[model samples]
Target: MRGKSSIEVSAKLKHSFLFPDEYLDWANETENNFYVESPLIYEVAFYNGIKALKPWETIEYIPVVLTEWKKVKLEIESKFEKRDAKGATLPMRVGIGLFLELLFWTNGQPVELNPIIPLESLKIKPVNITERFAFILARPNLFHSYKQLAELMVEMEKLYVKSIIVRK
Candidate 1:
């Protein structure tokens, strides 16, 4: 019964887009349940600036390294390149969001930005908060053209590369 209930809850979460806070709350309630993996939701919360109530001390925390950054950059670049080659007109919002999500996972202190900034933007400017941390400033737009999104990704890559260099 417990396994079934947990599966249902997990399915619901996977199917619907919930705010980070909602996922955090669900994870907190089910953290002790072996059938439910709370750490995954905790990751989503952490990426969105909500610290988990109970840190996963037992779990190995793999901080993003230079190799990981390179992997992510190459993957994203390949995706966009393929899309461009196919002449697809798909919106780049999702790709941009993925970039930001990955950026937040980097080792650093969380930097707060104005709440007014739209989560998805054509141009996301990274403001270096510390030697290894940044807060993104997003210019509001309904959608991003391929060229604009590619440029933004390049800029973000430069910032991450600089931070990685400082960390080394």
Candidate 2:
């Protein structure tokens, strides 16, 4: 029964157009591709994450007001744990990676506000699927087909770029 369900999902995925044909072709080419399951569950998970962001309409930034650094860090960590529990896929890890980058990136930038200023905040921008795949490509050793994936993402980006809006 489990095998039947897996097969059914695979059939549906091939026709779903959730990802570009080039990407689907590359992912399906190898049986032992790193973290690239035949059913492409991880890719689907990543797509689902991006869809949650409503990218077709607008790319939303998660606004977080700063009170104390530690408190914000803890809250983010808790959210990460919850997301991980659902499925610790590439997208989830990319989110945590972006968070870490934000921490470091913000530290060097100068702020003109007074030290006691209230509600000073930072926005966490959403990374599109192509960007997320590029992030994964940075660690090429993890996936043998990383270069192909990167190329495919570029194509996918070109096709869908017009529909995506960057919200101010």
Candidate 3:
């Protein structure tokens, strides 16, 4: 996405995403390419099944975009996001979503909220391996962790570059 041209095209983006929520009895369908003001745990419903989801109480957001499948990597732990009063964006730390291959294959189905399910249950496989994961959460501590992780990634990339130059 960062390098691709606007005119360039690839496999069309998957319009529908599966949101998995144990609270939901089943999956439901609407027009493709919809977003909720808040996060709804769902599957790529076009495939997962159909149902209604609990109304979001804390955040108002929509699915941002069906992205190329590479950026969505996750790790497990208490997550956080920084916000200001009224829950708006602020300079913040972010925690990581623990991603596993097992979670990726969950039929993007909903599971009852239980301690056993330690990972996100569903994923939207819009393009490549990385599916679009729209998370509407209300944690602040995780954000700082994410900030640190992001910084680590930057450093890794720089080292990778330096190594390439040395090799040359």
Candidate 4:
């Protein structure tokens, strides 16, 4: 209960080495001090970088395909009710947050979809690519300390900067 928490003090010390001088100046000038100063920047950036690796970037559009689970469950309830009344073992076709993590921030702009695309016209297929998914929320990981987090920030800051600078 003094000036700064251990994590905060550690981050301030680490940022000097992690962020480039030019980026620091740019961050200062742009009124986005939190970008450079936040202790959680590394975890935030690492997660965002993970999101930036979507396979659909070449298509120049990312789709937020959502399946409402309860609705799906109800729709399919009759078929499975006799066999499995609980519906405890519902498969991926049922809505779960796993599919959401499969989505990433694509470089391509989000396409404004036409309201009239027939359901049959769309291809219904599983994602073919195999990739690691981090299902956890943004919180302190037991393995990565503030120092390790800062190191990750050093690696990802350039990408983060490039992405935000255009918006600025």
Maximum-TM-score candidate: 1
By lDDT, the best candidate is 1
Better of 2 and 4 by TM-score: 2
Q: Write the per-residue lDDT of candidate 4 for residues 1-168, one digit (tens) a residue.
A: 222211121222222222223121122222222221222232223322322222223322112222232343343344344544334223212222212221222222211112321223323212221111111112222122222322332322343345446656
Give me the displacement of residue 50 in model 2, in angstroms.
17
- Residue 76 in model 3: lDDT: 19
In angstroms, give how far residue 157 of model 2 lies from its true place: 1.1
Q: Against the true structure, what is every candidate's RMSD?
A: 9.5, 17.9, 15.4, 19.9
Candidate 1 lDDT score relative to the true structure: 0.36
- Regions more than 4 Å wrong, model 3: 1-33, 41-113, 120-139, 148-168
lDDT of 1 by residue, 1-168 (tens): 232121222322231212223333443444343211222444344444444432233212223222343454455456556655332321233343334433443323221223422223322245432211211113212223334444555656676566657767
Q: Candidates' lDDT values, in order?
A: 0.36, 0.30, 0.27, 0.26
lDDT (10s digit) by residue, model 2, range 92-167? 3333223322222232221111222111243322234335544543442333223333343333333333323331
* Ranking of candidates on lDDT, top first: 1, 2, 3, 4
lDDT of residue 57 for candidate 3: 15
